[model samples]
Target: MASDVEDGVCFHCLQPIPHGVELSVAFQGDDKAVCCAGCQAVAETIIEHGLTAYYKHRDLDKPQQTPLLPEQLKELDVYDNPDVQSDFVRNTGDHSKQTTLTVNNITCGACAWLIERELAKTPGMIKSVVNVSNQRLHIEWDGSIIKLSDIIARLARIGYQALPFQQNQIEANINARRKGFIKRLGVAGLATMQVMMIAFALYFGVVSDLDPTTQQYLWVVSLVFATPVILYSGQPFYKSALKSIQAGSVNMDVPVSIALIGAYIASLYAVIIGRGEVYFESISMFTFFLLTGRFLELLAKEKALKFSTNRLTYMPNLAHREYDGGLEDIAAKQLKINDIIVIKPGETIPADGVLLSDKASVDESLLTGESRPVTKATGDGIVAGSVNQSATLRIKVTATAQQTVLAGIVAMQDAALADKPKVQKAIDHIAQYFVMTLLAIAAVTFLVWSWFDPDHALWVTLAVLVATCPCALSLAAPTSITGAVHRLNRMNVLVKGAQLLESVKHLDTVVFDKTGTLTYGQFKLIAREDYADIDTINAIVSGLEQRSEHPIAAALSQLSDQPISPDAIQNYPGQGILAEIAGTDYRLGRCEFIQIWHPNWQPKRQSNVILANRQAVLAEFQVDDEVREDSHDVICA
Candidate 1:
């Protein structure tokens, strides 16, 4: 390789260096040929850290072929401003700011690992984690010393593009990925059917003593159909395998790519020579099934991530802000600190602010996991994402869009995703070595069969490669963990780390931080009128109750034995509902709701639903929070 360097060979990658290159570096007292300025910079960084041992270590590993740009070395002072950093950066109580960036051009796990390693070398950087599944990088650094743009620039220099993470961008990327996979799957499925039909016809013709020319023609047609199935649908596996090998590690894709390419090459040679048997049908079938499994798995991952995107819903799309001496509608992201915003009943609070009104009740179930509404008075601080249950109020904004406590929680969750749990790390360590062991076994099988049955050696080796590909083995743990996460998310139980699953199993006792954690904290029926009269009233009461989502409406809805059909249901924002049920035209809501229709009806002032007709009071339902039936069983378990 050193002799060929003078003839335009790269000393670092050992590939033919292109012309118009002035890149060179001195290593071990000799001038080495580098393909570009990026290679020279990487070589210098490795040697500067006394990591020249990697040069000798990577000799047996495949060299990287990624193209890097030199223009990314420009200064990044703009990111140091606090206003610009507020868009995507979150503060963790001190000078440290955490940011999650979506990266492009990540082909495999090694690319993520390389980006992480390079980022850790920067000054004032606390830590960097790269999630290979989504190609997202989570970084925490001190803003006082380093800026956000510097980290992004470093990633660009190493053949990757880094930008502030956005949900819409990720959704678009997922759609594109799904479309590509579906198209490939369709092509492979169609090709497999055509090839299998040709193969069956050829086999039957042999028994019927068909002519040689017709059999050759059918074989040629089958080869043409199988070609696209192997090259197009099977391309992803080969690309992943190459990246893994270049990074000095082996992944499950190595064996899969080998099996696919090997079978295609063998079958292609057989068809061209017209003497050996062809396995065109077998190759096409395998490719189709593989693509099908991969597409389904991709969909499952997309759904799992979709559950996580709910965190973004905390920020409202629009906010009512004080502007030009009156309230005006504006995008939530445009709101600045000290801006006063009005929030109505049942509306989600758009930002963290201080209450400017006398009193209000807010339900912060999304953040605190508490079902009961908490009361707040004037000058009290309110959090973003909490619902204003009752009473409209004005609040002065204290934090911007990405700097709120809710955004901080989202940033923490993302940071947790980038870190590997103990069990996951162990699994990854075992998987890396397992790939090497399989390669060795395949080699031994080939040599043993070549001694006695030389013609069957390649066939036996291919079978071994396919049978022990390790795809299922590597996927088993992640799939189970992902399903568990989906189930827990539905229950409002958020788990940030995978190791928590194993760790919780070994605990002697479990603890909850709040009352709602162990109890339902929802209203249950406490008192009612006579059943004979209540049953008749409940049938009419279910009409208005079913239409409202209020907790009281839900509690009342559970009393009726059957669902009642109601018509002309009208909702009053701050008061209640008025509907015509069974042509009785009853009103079931607060005392005010009944008084609106009947001026003489005087209902008691208490926590109860007033049910009345046009003339008199019919029945009243009382409710309160009671301990859940399953709470005791759950505590014991």
Candidate 2:
């Protein structure tokens, strides 16, 4: 679809667009476009002259454009520009590896669809996914074939700009969102208060006592005051309620919307009929409280959502691939199975793949919440988003973009959000029964009171209908869960939803995963003994350990600063390494190895390994795996 920019005035300059004027620069959903090249040239001049009118006049409805395809991107030749390439590589990491990029100008879900679709058009581009809410585009491509600058420039033509986000910038953006929510809440609160005051005067008949004709004046004043409050202050509630109904579901906002509308309509009827004794005051106050609660709940829910999704978002958006022996940058979302990519130290793995290199160590804490780094060997599986802790490594993608472990985490979050809380279900049940009960009570009260006085019965019926609404009862669950979520967020525990919190209160058995859950999974060098020289032994161990995936071998490899290469190494599965170093044959395994070498040597009972040459025992190493500090406390609690 064509962008909404053509239909609307420039938001930045607030100038009316003339007919038949072609756009010189296309504005993305969140940016501004100039009508001609002359306008753009002048606009740049204006910005250079320190006037921000260009920014002020920019269209905010323009959606973020997609990254360029390898063929389309070839026009820019970013790799030839050393400065651009350096900046790109610095921000995104090596062009042969995958890294993330944060794009600005994403506006809505449609923009996300467009960007993803556009990037997929590129040859050698594996995947591209745009997150509209956060304005980010994750791309995976063969860096050797595609240049990031070319891709970004193509996005610029469509009115979107991709900017790499520094860690500090992400934090600043989060703070800005918080400030906006606060300001919105403040505006709504002030408007609500003013409306409530006008409602109170109208309800108490303060103006009615002045004069009969003046009562109409008071009603008009009240209507004028309440209109803006309902339109502006309660807009979020209205939008949410409508969205819920459209989706064929009822949320907490549905009842609130119904109550507000019902009260307002009834009060409007009374005023029009010259019987202005209706509860307008109740209606106004009800809306005020409801909006206040909603605004607060939105803030809490946003925090919870951020917490649950933050770790997943840390994955790089782009992966580099080798094409014709040159580097190219592509969207991470476009990555497919069997694609080969490089990974540098401190860079995140972009997909579930098998390492092409001999060995590498990665921190898997993002996925399993474990602090230990896992050593992966050639042909070993590596999940996306795992941070490389050692030297650079190459891997061939084994899974597509959507089938990754991180993708599963995102799917889990989505499932969690879709599942209703037990409390919400209970509230739904109560609302159903409450509606029927209120109808019955209103009828019974009218019938019983009508026998005595018809007028009294009418008032009693209205009271029952208005007072018996399940607003407060329905509110109980959301309010409590929202409060609890806020508290948990403050403590750094992000609950995915209110339902998760509710489920936590009902959990009877906690199943702990043994490997990384209850234990401090990191391997430590408890002791190192040198037969001839400590440094020589360390270097030899590091060299031989480099090829092994055993945790003990990984720990020993990390302890030495010197480089060493192993010769004639042989692996003893479930035991240890048997190799020849400097023409000396040595076997390194559990304490049993030493006992076999020297019958007189006694082995320690602790988790220890002994090293021995063909002649006699050499040295013994003991290690201990400690449980996490809170493991026992959590178990006992």
Candidate 3:
């Protein structure tokens, strides 16, 4: 059977197409054949530009082409509908739905804390975790107690804009935030350097010839430079602090904002009187350092890119929906259970369904660990993210978009952010209490100092506030987690939350899978012995393994400068790979898998990746992963 693209069937008209025309249309992020250039350009242009004039302004004889209508402007209550909720909300418990929402205007840790604090009062909110790095909210609530719309409305009431999570929203948010933060950071950084230079002349008398009249000039100049840094670059601190206070709580930024505003006022008073001290340099310097640290942390998080598979990111947004013995392209989210759909070879199976085709081959690598394609026939269950391999398939959908296994995996990922580890919770509580107590202490110290030395009371209080700002204490758990999470993410490990790693001490008994959990999933190379030629084996092995996604394959990928492509490449999941390299058949895998090619071959150890040709074992490579540090101690204890 010929594929539609190869059969020269025009995607636009479904007519016999000219072979040499080479015109195509992009449909649902994939290319399709078109019979003529005119058919290709107009439809694609309309789709891309949303031009409805061609249809709307057409004459009546044009058969009344359907006018493209704007998607209805939605009220938040629309999310309460199961049809709309099906996109980003998934059932997680008997009466609960877990939701992932992309949020905007979250600038600091305090914003996240304020969100969590406010939502804690909502009756149905089981959990809410706001990630400041990417501004995503992972929330779960009992459907019986409240609705998703109410959750979103509450977020809006707290000065946040939220919508159903979309794949690109987080990235878009980060990019927008990065641009704005860069501008603010540049202001603070340059102003800090200027203020510091002027401060040196005033503080240490750097210019011996500098006199009182000139000194007053330099102090005013320092104040001039520091003004914009405090007002503009320091906006985030003030906004987050005000939100926290308005919500009837204190956050780390409460101290920060207090110090920033208090110092700026004191500095202004000193410049006016020409009689006292100013901390314009401290204000500028502190803001610059804070912004710098946050910028680097964001870059690290950007490097710790998400594993897109967890969200089925590769799945097409549109699918071929079977309608009355014909197929129509429609949004995949619009698919319903029992809706039949066509799956051509090389296309991803869109939703969980049962195969209706007589026979088909599917690459179920995403659902199962097996890399080799699996054969299926009528009535066999199919998965959403699997790729159709050999023949075209018609599948009767068994589950809708939200009910698919891939969506379930995404829901589980959201649930990972549900709650805090007990110790982290304790630390956060202490930090909050510490803020309240320190404010009291600063007030008392000011009162006592005013009695002994009225001249310096304001400075003493300002010093107490700035020096004791509990930013580090308040940020300990989150900062520690992101730093560690960034490292683990580089190794393809996704940590659920601070609890997963930090709460291990509370586990009395621990159990872990051998390959990826008890030990690092990576396989370290020990040696490569008795190869036909070092370069040849390296090229052959690298070529095959580089094309594969198996864990062990990564260890040998760096052996060659470039991989040599093989012919007739075949992968046997639990056995080995069979291929032809340079007109010679080669096998690489377990000793047992290589035994057919070289019968007398034996593995030197309990495990080895042996490479063999027709006659003898050409190479035996050793690989191992040391048990994770303290694994034994934790399990025994």
Candidate 4:
């Protein structure tokens, strides 16, 4: 291979390296010749990410192709253009621009720490925060000191690819990220199991009559199996540790990475010297567990985000706007106040508006908790996110996009998330110094062990670092809050912030609003007084109620399982029902209407409906609000 490379062949692609060409890539501490800038970039990207082992692990016959860029990269420069920036980037202040980007290949909190640390060193950076759960990078920077493209290019060098966040593509990005984590975790799990099997065989070799060469062979096999676990599955730990140290700070990952790598190196050295013990199983197991914890956190964060986005999903990207003389579909965000828009049957309302049509039936369950369709007439106000359940209607816009009520709910969720609880802020402050203290303990451990027993100093120190890394303390708090909020959303409770969660333990007096909160808004039959035969009452009431569209009619309709046809029925809107059955006139309505027939008759109890004839009162009916199933338990708890 060396002679072939010396004969004018590119070291990477095996293509002919042109005479006097100067392209090269650093690999394994040496420069290797390449055919062009593309080959150079590809080689450098591979090496810088600690993936140079791919050069050896890959099949020999694999074809090499290149798509790379030079130091003055052109592809990233497109992001610097104002047109490209307009999609995701926005000006927050005169000198500051902020954006949210989906970051690729983040496995844990340490990756977030690394990104933040590096960005803080840049000249123009104001702030950079990584949401480990969503794998998103939120950045704010001053434009005077650096360009946005340059910041992105800096991320590329640190082994991450970032793109402007697109809501339509969020689920796809989440799936891809989940798949990558699963792949890495699976590799670590399988490799750990195999190494443990080998570990048992090596233990047998030590205590039994196994030959020296056989024991050596088992150790070598363990090394081979553990290599991938350390290099690929455990890549994020090492990467984060290096960046943390380079930034003159310490992260929880620093101790973990040091312990894991230290063990591997120590075991490898012992293997080569043909003496001492190996800990491949320990290394493999650590990688698997760390990945499992991060995966769970990712899932919890995803669930929280889903609950938050459920409201926003009702917003349609386009709305039918009445333009000049014809209807045109335009971006919903472009809609303005008083803009007339057409809503078809079964389509969601694009904005809050007033009805221009004579009449329409709308399903407002998504916006309001009410399940029944509301009947709206001309000049009645309608809100966005309601579905038109009847005929097509034209509405004049009152609020569009973010100005709508649905957007306010979404914004409240964002505001709640932004306002961190006192405990979380305190924990964050402690966690910063937590790693430094762990390092101090490690230093004390190393020095004490070195004086007592020189040979075991490194091993004991590594064990201390690994056993007490404090990873769970730093991760558990925020994820628990997110998970709690998500669970509450499932129960139809909207939690504004972590303050509610933190203060739950001290909850004393619980006050609840009556209708639609503690109790269902739909009326429930409570009591009834009858002066007429039960059979006659059931048939007549069912017939009368079946004719009207009012909500109370449905409740009264339940008074009978079977329906009876009345000779004639008439509905007095917002009043009562008038019907005739068996040559008798029946009135089911206001007590005042009943009093007209019986001048001295009066109701003895509180009632919703009074059934009477011209002679006397026949029956009285009462309704009560139905309470929710959990209302009692919630109050007591």
Candidate 5:
């Protein structure tokens, strides 16, 4: 009867209905429920079955703002259970007590202030920092009493989610960056085109040369069109320049900012003076080109940041924290110094710590850029961010999360912002004198041309200023750096930055690690000698060696090819293994273990192994290692 748009489109059904058509679907909030009478009945049944929140949260297609209050979190029974609390405390160590979460949900400085105020209300929270650009929060809190889950759940209630570092989320994060860049680029491009069109009309005497009054009218039109371009399209440059100035550093944006501001003021001056001959089109075009370059640079930087961030985030979200004769998985961030953590095979070590269990081969390639795995034994120190390749390890954390190698990588990335390429330095050098040189040339030209013709001086000065713009100089460095970076990326060698490329090109010496880098460090069995009644020796050596991750152990295991179990096995560091099988005892290792029989015998190389009984040498095994196929070429190249 109302004949309103809302009545025509059924609020619940979300479909246009004839004026007399009956609709049975019920509407809630701002969402439409599209259904027939029977379907509406089913929908109501679903909502009554505790699915209303699901529909409401889903209908909005936005993150639900369901804040978990501290009291509710406590009731979740997380704090009451000493075992759970101790597990979390042990895994995160005492360092979690001093750390705080800095959240990224603060959309602006005002939002940041508001979140900080809320966090400050909570006891034991020393600080809350928010970085809006990356959408990260740094929080410091006392772990002795408060818990990280409580903090995270509290943030979630306020419409912000605290995302722990994780590798699986990398693709989504990268996509978001790409989308943001595309949106900004689109807006800047559209504004650039509109401004250019207005500038062109004013430049070519389209409507400006009609009459004095008409020229004034045209000037107003140009100003109206250009305002959006300078404000919206040029905002990034202005912001970047201001940030650099505040930090007392010079970035590429500083010169671009100067140029844009100068062009805007000069163009406005021309309009006021009733002179439309000046090339304001050039200024608009320059802004557009400069912004295009900046967008490309930002895209490149985002890609690099994403790659390094993903690497740092590869550690598991939770770690098994050891407590009074048991273990429980807790958030990795809660891990503290001196906490024992059990790492299963194929799991990454989450923090820098000391290995408590014996023998683990860890892949440190991601952090050190090395391709080989390092064998770590009991009492050996393990760096954070390295991947455990083969055996399970239990480690006592020596440093907290923020004090580990992963944190160092994060710090290095932050410091790398100041790292500039060779091309940027060249541009900076040119920019230093560009403004002064242009002014001097314009002044000389004006004085020289005034004697010949009074009107010619202004034209000469404008010509010098316009033609001598630093477009070519700006293009020179970025073009080369971009090409080099692209080429290097194609080759699978990710140079950290353009500055690193210079270091690569000028490298005077190259170093190689002898063990895995130059040679296949894995051992291969050449041959084995047989002896009577020595099946026991074979069985004992193989069983004891299976427990060892050393290259020699691997070689022996392959040669024996027999299922053997040692009655008892003991490892002697820097020597070898002692084992007993059946009624016989055996030792497998250095020549010193068999030196009683062959006192004059010495190993030809480090790869040889000797077998002996109490009275005589029984057998000897020879092993050899060969260089990697690429070793020669890598050295020569």
Candidate 6:
């Protein structure tokens, strides 16, 4: 049935190659066709490294990646030049620079460890850290000795693709991680249910009444269902265990992985030989429960970090930058120092900059914890992440995206996450040693039980491993702290870290900031001097308040319905709005602006909004602070 033509199978995977396929590479002096580009690149790499023996022994079903082609890899060579690398590298003292790289093909914790170790062994490398959540590798090295290209090339040799870190790419990587976790959890959960069904049938003696062959057949079915759960669903634990041992330390995962794998293997042997009691149900149940707990923990961590991650929404994605003859909209991150950016009312400031306009009021309650809108004028610095509350303003950037005050706060929060509280560190240390001790006990129990009863030694040993795991013990503090944090967040209290819980226990005093922090900062219109037509007065006052950005102005502005836009408007810095409405001039401000029209008007002891014209005082709006009801109770308590 074979054709006479020279049709061939892939040399690497031994899959049939179609005619006209271009995926071929020279391997061990023989030209061989590969099934696809991914296989072709892998074959070339193996042959180039004199590892063609891998082709003869590798699992044919092993997955492969479509790696970058040789020509595409040549672009990375630009990193060899200092000038070209400066965009992604930051220089420190001693001719060293640090860079964060996005590494692809990191399927497990072991891959991260391998990349770190390989980088550590390089001559000029000082440090390397891989963040598994974001798949980002931070590296510091002596640029004088190791070029950027060299570091990237070495990681590529280890079968990972490295490039400069991009925010979008990192986000995609995180999403991929969550998707994978959810998929594995689903598979494990399904297997657990199926295994438990068969297990319960045997437990209830329903299958015990059946013949020996029938029970054996049920055990084999359970084994078939549990294999994928133990191997694929629980693969991360195995990889983590391997890395922990390679690092000369132990963690909770080591004991967990050992117990799961050991139990599964024992069950497998028993099922194959058909002479011993099998643990297929136990392995399935254990893997499913452990994975469920881990998935919940990941969700909890994401929820706890939501407060920090949500802050990024305060910065606008786009800004109107001043350009030749007009303004152009550009990404906020592209802003540079000395460039002028135009921020309109109600929009957030893009960066820390100096206000170039005459004046504006900015709401900085979120950034500085100030409940009031702070007024800024020409030459005054306006911080990023604050809203432009009143007037349009042109600001000249004084800091780049990464150097802004908001960025610094985010950086501090990240640093806090990296550090462990004393109690947490102590717990982790205990857990690490606990794993080592548990392993020793498991081995001893197996040997001692074997001496007394060889037939049941494996089951007793499995009991020792499962019953003694410290998963719940290690999770206690973090789970309690995370729950407490979520509760506090609902009550408008933001606790930045678990260390706060430790500090709260010793608290002797409490302090609070007034104005939005403890009391409502806005004003309530309580009275009016003259009983003019309420509708007419409301309309006129709203027009005047529309041009002002003061907090009081906002309160007064909200009291009107169908507010009329003034035909012309002008603002006095720190004063109020001057406007012409319906062919009549009106001034709305403090007593000073009112005095210009009515010299007899005097300052009221309480907060008052005075409206006037060239002829006389039109109205005086009396206002008062509407304090929060809970403020009194909170203060007393």
Task: Output the number of the TM-score-best candidate.
Answer: 6
Q: Name the regions of candidate 1 deviating beyond 4 angstroms.
A: 1-85, 103-125, 130-136, 144-163, 201-215, 245-249, 436-454, 512-525, 529-621
lDDT of 6 by residue, 269-381 (tens): 88888867777778878888877777776665445545434354567778899988599998676678899999988899988999999888898876766655798878999
Superposed by TM-score, candidate 4 places the C-alpha of residue 205 at a distance from the truth, in angstroms, of: 3.3
Q: What is the TM-score of each candidate against the true structure?
A: 0.71, 0.52, 0.69, 0.66, 0.48, 0.75
Give candidate 6 regions above 4 Å deviation.
1-174, 206-209, 246-248, 478-497, 521-530, 543-551, 564-567, 571-573, 622-625
Candidate 2 ranges beyond 4 A from true positions: 1-220, 230-279, 413-417, 420-430, 436-466, 472-637
User: Per-residue lDDT tens digits of candidate 3, residues 213-278?
Assistant: 888899899989999999999987888778768767777778778888998998899899996778
Q: Model 1 RMSD to the real structure?
A: 13.4
Residue pairs whose backbone atoms clash in candidate 1: none
Model 4 alpha-carbon miss at residue 329, Å: 5.8
Model 6 TM-score, 2 decimals: 0.75
> lDDT for every model?
0.72, 0.58, 0.72, 0.73, 0.57, 0.69
Query: Over the stretch 172-193, how does candidate 1's per-residue lDDT look in tens digits?
Result: 4566668889999999999999
The digit string of per-residue lDDT tens for model 5 on 1-637 reads: 1112253443322333433334344435333433233224334444444444433433322222322222333354333233333322223235443232224322222333335556777776755654323344556577655666667666655545554432222233444445655665666566556666765665666644666676676666766666666777677667655654453333345555665666677668778897735444555666667667655654554454344433545666679999998999886767888899998766888888998886777878667655446877889999888877655688999865556766656534432422446556645456535645766776788798998887556655665665675545644454455455645555444455557766777888977765555766555666666454567556656677778755556677654568478778766644666676676666677688667556886655453676665555556677555568899899999
lDDT of 1 at 578: 70
Best by lDDT: 4
Residue-wise C-alpha lDDT for candidate 4, range 1-637, written one tens digit per residue:
2222454556655555655566577766677887654345446555655555546543334333221222333443545655445435666568787777767656445556667777989999997866555666778899878888788778867767676664533554555557778999989999999999999888787678778898889889999999999999987778767766665666678899999999999999999999887899998998899989877777776666676545766676679999897999986756888999999866889899999998877877676667456888899999899888656789999977555777666545544654457776666667767778888888999999999998899999999999988787667766676677768878777777757888888987867756577888776777889998988787778778777655556688877877688898766543577788878887887777676677787777888788886667889888666789999987788
Q: Where does candidate 6 have its weakest 10-residue lDDT segment?
A: 63-72
How many clashes show up in model 4? Answer: 0
